[model samples]
Target: MRETVRWRNAVFAVFFAMGFGFASLAARFPTARDALDISVDQLGLALLGISIGSIAGLSTASHVVARLGTRAVVSVGVVVVGVGLAIAGWGVEARSMAVLVVGLVVTGLANGITDVAMNLSGAANERALAKPIMPIFHAFFSFGTVAGAGFGALGEATGLGMGPQMTIVLVAIGALSVVVRPRLVEQPIQPEDHVGFRERLSVWTDARTWLIGGLVLGMALTEGSANDWLALLMVDGHDFDPVGAALAFALFLTAMTAGRLAGVPLIERFGRVAMLRATGALAAVGLVLVIVVDDQVVALVGTALWGLGASLGFPIGMSAAADDARMATARVGAVATIGYVAFLAGPPMLGFLGEHLGLRDAMWVVLAFVLLSLATSAVAREPRTASGAPDPAAEVRP
Candidate 1:
């Protein structure tokens, strides 16, 4: 138990750093916009480069993690994120939009690498520990979001150009990540499954895998939506100040952490499917509350519902992806990659919907997908484990 706790602690720290760095970009949005002198549409386009890079990088993640092992991969990922942040910060200081875009692309790639590697490593750790651990790892990300908001305010107070401010933040987090890595159980990754392209294609073609994968896709979309637009909606729709708007996100993530801690036991009592169904309703209810309420307190409660509903998705989905006895790790990787692509696509698509139909209406679209995921989860098949999990039917949520 002690070793297990230490390993998870390391994973948690890395997650915290990644989440903090990523969330800080939310703070920099206005600065990026003003520095480039661009309209909202142009700003969206420029930012789309990051999403594009994430999509491209996710395609190769299994290969990278398989070859490098999670330890080295995670280490490199942290460094990459730090360097990309620095570059973006430098671009902002230089007042070069082109350079900023390039920097964002690099940042996106780094984000993609870390995202997949950490999820895989977290899953591996959960398996080794014989417990549900992924939620705790993600809980740290929530902590980071709260911390990042503060970090950003400090950066702004210093009156440094975004480049210097963000670089300092990223560098500090990256150093912590290095210190954290050695404490974890870093194992040598085996060579990826040798199934050829034609075999891999067959796994993708399966109806059940797609059903499970679709659940992953929807959840990813919902989380990404919260990440990209929760602050904007509070500010634009509710007329919140910057700090107030950020607090909405902080509320949402705090609820997410609390929910995950609660979820461990619930997932133990029920399978991934039952918990997913519950979260879907919870999220939809939250969205409705946010849309209909006038009181700030009520609105914040709605965000908390949204967070609780979203907390367990990736862990559950990854388990489902590996459920097929016949599927290879490569195929599992493919499904996970597809889900992230959905994540990349979701936010901007939501932005477009928000722009055209109002943010509330766009938020409704997310609820629609959440409902679909709930229905799908009811029948989602379990992954066929190579080593029989301590108890597959036990409360393993992820």
Candidate 2:
């Protein structure tokens, strides 16, 4: 149990670092745009670099983890993230859009690799702990985003540019990664678990896998759209200043953190399907409020609801994909790949829509996806046991 606790803590640290690194970039999006002197549409196209790199990373993460193990992949992912941040910072300082795109691509790849590796670690730990702790792990990620956005806001208030701000964050994340790497469990893929390359590619044939991936795609869009656009939306759509926009973004992250922390018990009581349905409705309403309502206070409330609604989808999808431990890595990779398509396609699509229809109107695209998730929530039901009975032991509890 003590070792389990240690491994859990280690995995939490990795998730936190990943969140911090990503949020550090996210929080600085406005500054990055200004430095490059680009329009919203152009920024969206450039941000596609992240999606491209992430797709590449997700495509190969399962195979890499199978060979190099989770710890090593996570460690390498940290270094890659740090380097990517530095290059991104340099791009901003140099006022080079090309450099910035390259940096974002690198950061996205690292984010993808670490995302799969650490979630695998988290899922293994969840099985060992025999509790519904994936939400808590995701909560730490929200906490990290909260911290990163808070610091970014502070840096912006103090007139610090992206370069200095990211440098400080990169150093801190690098140090934390070093501290936690050794403590991660060395759970390499077993010999029997290994399969031929053709067999490994066969996860796509599973309908359940694609259903889960579809759910995650909706969640990822809901979450990623907010992460990439909320601040900009406030500024462009609502006529807020930079500081106010950052505050709104911070509020979103805080609300998400709260929801995830509160989610474990709710999930324990309601089960994954019911909880997801409830939250999905809340998120849809929140999006309506943000888009249709004219008042800032009401819109901010909508943002909070949106955050709370989106908090569980990605984590729950990950948990569902890993329900069968034997095929966890492959399923996770496929689902992540399918889900991240939202991330890849969302920015450019929204950017073009925002350019034509206005940013607030562009967000209406998310509503369709959220409804899709609600319809598919049943796919996340707990796995059945050998006798074809729903496995009570597999139901996660707080």
Candidate 3:
């Protein structure tokens, strides 16, 4: 019991650290673009490095985790993330596009691997606790992003250069990882249980796996769109100043974080399918409010609703993916890959559509995806057992 408690706390810390480091880098995007003297389109292309790297990393994460175990993969991955951060800082200071692209790729690769390993660990801990704890683990991630963004804001206010600021932050993150390393619980894969690449890909053939991936994709895109464009939406659609737009975005983040923190009890009571459908509907309503309403206040309310609605989907989807302990790694990795492709690719796709339809109209695309998530929510229900009851042991195994 004590060990479970420790592992849970450690997972929280890992999620938090990952969130902080990623946000710290993200907050510098505008600064990096300006430093490099790149056009917005150019910057988007540059950001594709992260997408490419993440795809590569996620594609092989199961194999890597099988060999190294979650603890080693995540620990080493965090340290690598720090190294990537330093390189990105240098790229920004030097204004070298090639270097910056390489750095982003490295960071994305590390983040991708770390993301799978940590979530697998979190799912394992959830089994040990026999409760719905994944949402709170993700809530800590949100907390970390808020803190990291604040750190970046402080640097901006103080006129700190990007290189020095990232260097300082990454070093701290790396040191924290060392402290976090031993706390992560190990999941041993027996030699016989380990499979080759072809066997691992079998999860890809499962209909339920694809359905769960669809649910995750929609919810993830809903969240990712706001992350990438919410402030801009406020500014462009509502005529808000930069500060006000930022505050609005902050509200969205706060609502999302609060939602995650509050989700587990709700999920436990209502069950996964019902909660997913409910949240998907909420997100759709929020999108409609923003897309159709002209008033700024209405848009702000919609943004909050959107955040709240989008909050639980990712974690719940992850929990669903890891439903079967024996296939946890492959299923989790596959589902995550689908969701992340949405996250990384959705924003730019919206940017493309936004050019023709305007940002507000472009949100119709998101609405469609949210409805798809709603439609697919049923698949997230725990698989049935021999007696046709929910598999109690499945939840307990990972």
**Highest TM-score against the true fold, candidate:** 2
TM-score of each: 0.87, 0.96, 0.91
lDDT of 2 by residue, 205-237 (tens): 999999999999999999999999998999888
Candidate 1 wrongly placed segments (more than 4 Å): 1-5, 93-95, 154-160, 184-202, 323-328, 379-398
- Which tens-of-lDDT digit does each residue in 109-155 have in candidate 1? 87787777776667666766767666777778777876776666556
Best lDDT among the predictions, by candidate number = 2
Shift of residue 94 alpha carbon in model 3, Å: 3.2
lDDT at position 384, candidate 3: 79
Residue 4 error for model 2, in Å?
1.2
Local distance difference test, candidate 1: 0.71
Q: Candidate 3 on 1-398: residue-level lDDT in tens? A: 98889888988988888777766666556566568987544665666777777878888898889878999998889888877877887898998999888987998799889889998898888877887688999998888776766666566557688788878878888888888888888863223465677877999999988999999999988987776666657766778764466566667777788989988888767778888888888889999999999999999899889988988999999988887777889888999899888757875677666655677888899999999999899888877788888776664443
Instruction: List lDDT for all candidates, in order.
Output: 0.71, 0.86, 0.80
Task: Tell me how many residue pairs clash in candidate 2.
Answer: 0
Sort all candidates by lDDT, best to worst: 2, 3, 1
- Error (Å) of candidate 3 at residue 170 is 0.6
C-alpha RMSD of candidate 3: 2.4
**Pairs in clash, predicted candidate 2:** none
True-vs-predicted CA distance for residue 339, candidate 1, Å? 1.8
